[model samples]
Target: MARVVVDVMLKSEILDPQGKAVERAADRLGYSTIASVRQGKRFELQVDGPVDDAALASIHELAESLLANTVIEDFTVRVEDN
Candidate 1:
């Protein structure tokens, strides 16, 4: 078995309203060090594979096709062997 980790995030050029909301809250809490904030998604799945390069590619394709919308977001995938 292999474990796959996927990180989904909006493109930097896209405006992140939720992130802005968090930034607003941070500012309210007097956190001056936080210059910006962006919300993202994280997903981990156990895939049936030997954890090779091709298996990793399949995981990436699965994430791109079903897990995330590419119009405004990007995804990165990684696989680990068990």
Candidate 2:
């Protein structure tokens, strides 16, 4: 089996309300050493065959089209050896 990992994060220019809230909560909980937090999402896809360049390219397309919003978010996709 092979694994593909997709990480999605909001664009730096976009406002992240959820991240800000978590940061504030962390500060109130005595985690003030942390400067900020940017929340994001991860998607792990399991493929039945060997991971190759073609699979990586397909995963990249999937991540861009379905997993992340290109307008407001950026995504990185990587394949993990199984």
Candidate 3:
């Protein structure tokens, strides 16, 4: 079995309205030192493999295909010995 970790984040140019809204509210509450806040997603998975380069490539494809939207989001992949 192989373990995979995926981190998903929003594109920088895309407006993070959620973060902006939160920052405005916090400032109103006297937390103005905070400049920004971004929300992201992290996912973990287990797969069967002898765990070679092919397996790793397939995992990346799966992440791009189902978990991440290539246009507005970016993703990083990590593999761990398990």
Candidate 4:
């Protein structure tokens, strides 16, 4: 079996309140070196066979259509090493 990973994140122009809250918490915890934080979502899919170019293409389409909001978010799809 093969594993596919889909990572969805908001566009840079979009405000991330959850990320900001995390950053603020980090600062209060004395993590001064922490710069910024951006929260995102990750989806893992298990495929019955090898992940090839065609599979990647299909996953990309799935990410675009179902996993992400194209207007304000971006997503990347990749195969995960076993």
Candidate 5:
């Protein structure tokens, strides 16, 4: 089987309250070297056959249409090495 990964993240301009909260918590926990944080979503898909260009294209389309909100988020699709 082949695997594909889709990573979805909010746009830089959008506010990420959850990420900010985590960052603050980390600072309180004494992780001073830590910088900012942004949260995102990851989706892993398993395919029954070899990964090809057509499959990649389809996955990209799916990412754009269902995996992410294009107005506020961006997504990347890639094949995962087994």
Candidate 6:
């Protein structure tokens, strides 16, 4: 089996209300060193077979299409060795 990780996040141009809220809360809690915050998602996928070029390509496509909003977000996918 192979493990794949997908990280999805909002583009820099997009405003993140949730992240800002978290940042504010953290600041109020005395974590003043935090300059900013951005929220994102991580997905772990376990493939039942070998991870090859085609599999990687497919995973990339999946991340671009389903796992992230290309118009406002960016994403990266990588295979993790077990």
Q: Top lDDT: which candidate number?
A: 6
Q: Residue by residue across 1-82, what tens digits does model 1's lDDT show?
A: 6688899999999999999999999999999999999999999898764777888777888888988889989998876455
lDDT of 6 by residue, 13-78 (tens): 999999999999999999999999999999999987889999999999999889998999999998
Superior candidate under lDDT, 5 versus 6: 6
Provide the overall lDDT of each model, using Cα atoms, as 2-decimal numbers.
Answer: 0.87, 0.92, 0.84, 0.93, 0.92, 0.94
Task: Output the lDDT of residue 45, model 1.
Answer: 91
TM-score of each: 0.87, 0.95, 0.75, 0.94, 0.95, 0.95
Query: Tens-digit lDDT track for model 3 on 1-82?
Result: 7788889888888888887888888889999799888777899988775667887788799889988998999999998766
For model 6, where is the 10-residue window of minimal lDDT? 47-56
The deviation in Å at residue 10 for candidate 2 is 0.3
Clashes of 6: 0
Report residue 26 deviation for candidate 3 (angstroms): 5.3
lDDT of 5 by residue, 1-82 (tens): 9999999999999999999999999999999998998999999999877788888888898999899999999998888888
Candidate 1 stretches greater than 4 Å from native = 80-82
Candidate 3: lDDT of 32?
74
Q: Model 6, stretches more than 4 Å misplaced?
A: none
Q: Number of clashing residue pairs in every model? A: 0, 0, 0, 0, 0, 0
lDDT of 5: 0.92
lDDT of 2: 0.92
For model 6, what is the error of residue 59's alpha carbon versus the real structure, in angstroms, after optimal superposition? 0.6
TM-score-wise, the better of 2 and 6 is 6
Where does candidate 5 stray beyond 4 Å?
none
